[model samples]
Target: MNSFPVTKFYDSGKVHTTDTYYELLQLIDTKNIAFEVPKMGQKLPFDSVLGVQVLNVDSKASDNNDASIVLKAKYGKVSFLLTGDADVAIENTMLPKYDLKSTYLKAGHHGSNTSSSSNFINEVYPMGTVLSYGKDNSYGHPHKEVVSRLTTVKSKIYSTAVSGDVTVTTNGQAHSVSAKAWTPPTTTPTPPSAGTTGKLQVVKKDLSTEIVSIQNVGTTDVAMAGWKLVSVQGNQSFTFPTYTLKAGANVHVTSGPNAKSGGNYLKWTTANIWLNSGDPAKLYDSKGALIHEVK
Candidate 1:
């Protein structure tokens, strides 16, 4: 006896097979197998313990649209939407057809611009949005516009690129998100000294542009060569490039475009080096000694 893998298609008359399908057919002894065509508004008969619903499944839509499946799982009042690579078209079609509000949402198309429309996101109003994409992916998953839209909705966004293997636990009334792999940075911070360590203080921090200004408040000039500014959350560091800070002078370090080494500005070159919710900025000397830190 030979075993055959059974699959389902939307249209029974239009079923087609590929080369791999033909190879599998040859290995199976069964001459004919039936495929099930799920109805448009069909709901899976799962046990009452797990509340899962299939909201929409339109096979007449285009190839990408046809393959899309919008599913919502409910545990009492808490709900989750697990959308697989569904584009904006699929989302728009489902918006008015179903109740999309959920506690958690897996961002469509891995946060691609083709999906996660502002209208769709607003309709869902998820508390947390998770972008399931690889780190440094070639296609640049989680596009900035999508992220901005999610941010506008005040959604806590988590990306596999930054925090790996995120886990969410809920008891129907409340939910908490955590990543076991991510750990907060622990450092023995040094307090600001008046004149000994050059009195470096973080005068201002612009979270939007990741720009941090460190001022020398001491009476003597501070040799800034080999000094570093580090973010405690991400451990992102910016090293001074052979410059000297005179007394009462401030140097700006930006983590984005417009990097210049002139009168008072330096650039970190990397994007999003600082946490928006405020992280500790520690300044270290050339010998890896912590000189000053600002929270």
Candidate 2:
């Protein structure tokens, strides 16, 4: 079995949105893969197998929307940065905060101009920059401006979108890197393309009022209408029952003495809202407005 230490840092002070990482760990728990957590920005034990940390600086508010952390590691004279999706502004703030004399950099934010600032590039002075992106991606990532900037700094560029997986091995001050492509199984199942359709429902409640939301989860658009409230948190759910709903719509109802103050709560709270009274409360949308509500 192989063991490694891993740590993650976030510039934005919020938990991540996905759990796919945890799922991967579960698969390797008893396999040939093992890991531990080492302190951030510090060296591993002399006999250690792996060390991980994040580069987050400044007295910025902690939010998930901020850029990703600036990761650094060293083994002898060779050091590496496994930058996730860090943008330019965050890079500008971070470069001055750390000793970033790295041999390699996992180029920030998929080679977007929003990162890879001139000042940040000079600070890193990376021997090479790695770009990980999907080929023919809809977003047209790895913008030309970013690539040209890296060239002006004379940084060698490698890419996953073109060359595939890049692996680096370091032994003290000496290091080497290699690349290989990852291919899916021949029998792999293909999922549906974009523009499919699914249904989703959201519900929010408080002592003063309750709110309900319905939405589309499918690839296709869904409309809002015909939703109702069937339950509540306060003691007056039964007496103040008059809910209205429409097909392909979301219905939100606020009941009880606290209903008046509910709108203010809606403006700032991260609470979920539902517009119906059912055990498996389902919501359907035939229009594309639900995404707007979410943002």
The TM-scores of all predictions, comma-separated, are 0.50, 0.48
On TM-score, the candidate that comes out on top is: 1
lDDT of each: 0.70, 0.49
Summarize candidate 2's per-residue lDDT along 1-295 as a digit string, tens digits.
1345433212233333223335555545645353543333544343464444467522242432243445687666777887666666667667667777788888776776666777887888887788887775423457677777767778777779878888777776676668642232236334223232335445433322344343333444432222222322110111111222233444344432233324222121222222223222222232322322221
lDDT of 1 by residue, 8-96 (tens): 22221222223434554454425354444455556655566557777656555434333566678888788999887677877888888
Instruction: Provide C-alpha RMSD values for all models, in order.
Output: 16.5, 14.0
Model 2 clash count equals: 46
Candidate 2 lDDT trough over 10 residues, lowest sum: 233-242
